[model samples]
Target: MSSPPIITSSSFSSSNPFSSLPEDVIRAHIFPRLDGCSLASVGCVTPELHSLSSDHQLWSHICHSKWPSTTTSTLTHLISSFKGGSRSFFSLSTLPPNHNIPSPSPSLSALPDQIISAVDIFYRGKCIFSKVQATETVSGWFKCSPFRIDLVGPKEAVPTPISRPSHEDTCQNLYADLELSWIVVDPTGHKAVNVSSLLPVSVERHWLSGEVHILYATVVCGHVTCSVEVTCVGGGPGGLVLHVTEACLKMEDIDGAHLNGRDSLVVLQRVLEGKRGNLCSENRKMGKVEEGRKKYLEFLERRKERREKILRREGRLDNLCVMIGSFLFVGLFYLLCFY
Candidate 1:
């Protein structure tokens, strides 16, 4: 029996199939599959790849994928402000602000109407949920707090402690009515559950910077609850950054007794206590530790001032309450005697 000779096209048989394809084909077929990190690495390989990677359309997709809540107008404005266009903007958005890379300083005019907070929630050290949310200030008792808790969930009608703003106010400050939601995905069933209704238990301001820590806890499914604590920092001309400091999964048996919950709690405690790496190494490199110490002293002074203000306000409120009680007692005695 005779067999036909093996044949393979030289163009298709090459190890790098991307090189074989036309630039248009590569742009259309391959680039979309790459994320911002992958695109950056691939672009460095060759000038041709670099040119292909620099396309505005490619970077636009990457940016939108990373920050879906960003409006078209906002993206256009950001792209225009960056000298390197969308590619540069995407790189800046993904990379943590380090001294080595200059942070993008968009003019005030270019600031987006609504600031976007992109969050990635991890479970068991794996990314289970990621979403871009528009932050809104907490209202009522929490409004004046230095730290604000931004809530994000699935539905548009998620209840808020603060009343929705008036039309005029919302129009004037687009950031006022921005929606925040949290999308929690179950790793076991691979199903996504929106815990938008769950409110943060606490929001604390870090002393070092204007950063905030938000804690959220909710049950994703039966007998299982997940707790997520993230710190939002690094917002200026550059967008907001969220660092997931803690993610915990608690499980219970059918009888509602804790099952291995202590183990997970211990693991979470260890993780929280572990030392974190400094993102801004430039300060240390530039010998700015003295300047940082001064800043810390200023922070302490501010804390002292804030504490004094709070105590004075408390004193006033206590006096007002005592006066009100005394007046009520006098009125009651006079009424009884005269009657």
Candidate 2:
């Protein structure tokens, strides 16, 4: 009688459990279970998975899941133009922003006439508000005037089921409840980037109207940075009805000077082109919102230091000018007295 051959676990079942399963099963069942980062890691396991993970459909679904506003037909069409479709987009928008930007010179070559902003506001991991707004850049008004994108129109109250907190805890309440995603898509450039910190950078109460202003800021590329503000007002209990009284994004310099549309768009395009933070390792740990803000905070500190240096330089120049004028006046006075 021949000895029964031992059946090792590895021999009985292929080392790669997925190898035995049909590709369709893996694509339809397994890949969908993973996120963009996890799916990307699985792709590295074998050539087969790399192919399966590259499926545009899977990435498209992931994109739609994270950003509800990406489902819009206009934005969908724009996403399709990306080199690898939604996969390319996920890569750009998922990584922490790359603060390094090239020359701020305006370029109309690849600049789109309009941009689509896909915004989602989440509270405690559940989406409470989602909207898509289109901002037209072709207007002369846009170019000459300040660069701003208003998602919520005046007199428009976007109701949410969140309770208005007591005046004292309002700031903390808003900070704890809200996390935002603001993805900007460019059709002509075929680029997309999330220009938000995923958390409110600042929350302040208006001393006059009792309104709360929540600000989310990010460094666009170079000296130019962008910030989005969502203003929320009080609603009677159950009227816990939340309204986005104002949801506006404005781009400005470190010195608080607003950039014109052309210049703002140029810096924005540089962001789409340069994302040095894409080094998100496989099995990617998407950074914590607090950690994501490190670069932003550092940028702010850098700006502060720069401003102080400028002020010091100007002070020295002023003192030198004063001394030169005083010396000349005194010399003339002595000459007249002697004469």
Candidate 3:
């Protein structure tokens, strides 16, 4: 130190080392700030860049950037949708009838939970698929997929959707045979819904832009439906759940279908029952939650406790207010502070 005349690196290293770095280098530092979808996109820019992004470090960084405040499940679902994975099954759309129905005394808004429960009961296990096709002379047709989702309310059902192992080498084809959908239930009820029917998907590259897009065709109810362009997205560990927030079903398409609203609800109820039966059978095989009867009972107990706790908390707050008022009354009348 004496010989070097007290040279200090911290005091004088002010030159912008990174400022002069190449654009790619700058991008490396900047890109980690982006979410998974954007980061995946960045990797496709070039072969060299793709190699750099292949590092697990980059993926972890991108995953963390996925959503700042969302739950891991919520973020996973969002990412899955972005990646063109299974569409969420549970969607919450208000039944704004295409034609005016009688306005109820309390109005539909006042009893949303009832409306939702009724709808859920009606369509729980019945899949409603729509066909969307793009036409040269008219709006394209969109074919909807149909697969019923078993409802366990807000609780995660014992057997998860991810349990099935894949034997196929290709990830795309692995899930191609099975339809996937999602249902998201927040404390207030429904959030977002997605429904995806599986079909063979082929992605094509834009020669000029280098971007990727998907094309697929599948037989939807005996009709050969096709789409030239579709978003490519994937799901995460906790299977995505979606609920339609605002939806109006046009009853015009119900001409040939034997399933009426009540019948649909009955079908849903039976499907749920069948699922419970299957789960029970599977549990017997796995020795977990046998019959699900006990599990259902336990769920009810937990729900009761939660309601009680909420009521007790509200009561405590009210009592505290009363006690505070009583103390203030005595203080103001009797000069308690001086005493």
Please provide TM-scores, in order, for all candidate models, with all chains considered together: 0.34, 0.82, 0.21
lDDT of 3 at 90: 13
Best first by lDDT, ranked? 2, 1, 3
Model 1 residue 59 CA deviation in Å = 0.5
Candidate 1 on 11-114: residue-level lDDT in tens?
23457454467878778877777766667666666677778878888887776665453335633554556567666555433322111112333333332222
RMSD of each: 20.7, 6.4, 25.2
Per-residue error for 19 in candidate 2, Å, reads 2.3
Error of 3 at 339 (Å): 99
Please report the candidate that would top lDDT against the real structure.
2
lDDT (CA) per prediction: 0.42, 0.76, 0.30
Model 2: clashing residue pairs? 160-242
lDDT of 1: 0.42
- For model 3, how does the per-residue alpha-carbon lDDT over 258-322 read when each residue is reduced to its tens digit? 23333322222222212111111212322321222233334445556767888899999999999
Q: Rank the candidates by TM-score, best first.
A: 2, 1, 3
Report model 2's TM-score to 2 decimal places.
Answer: 0.82
Off by over 4 Å in 1: 1-18, 98-339
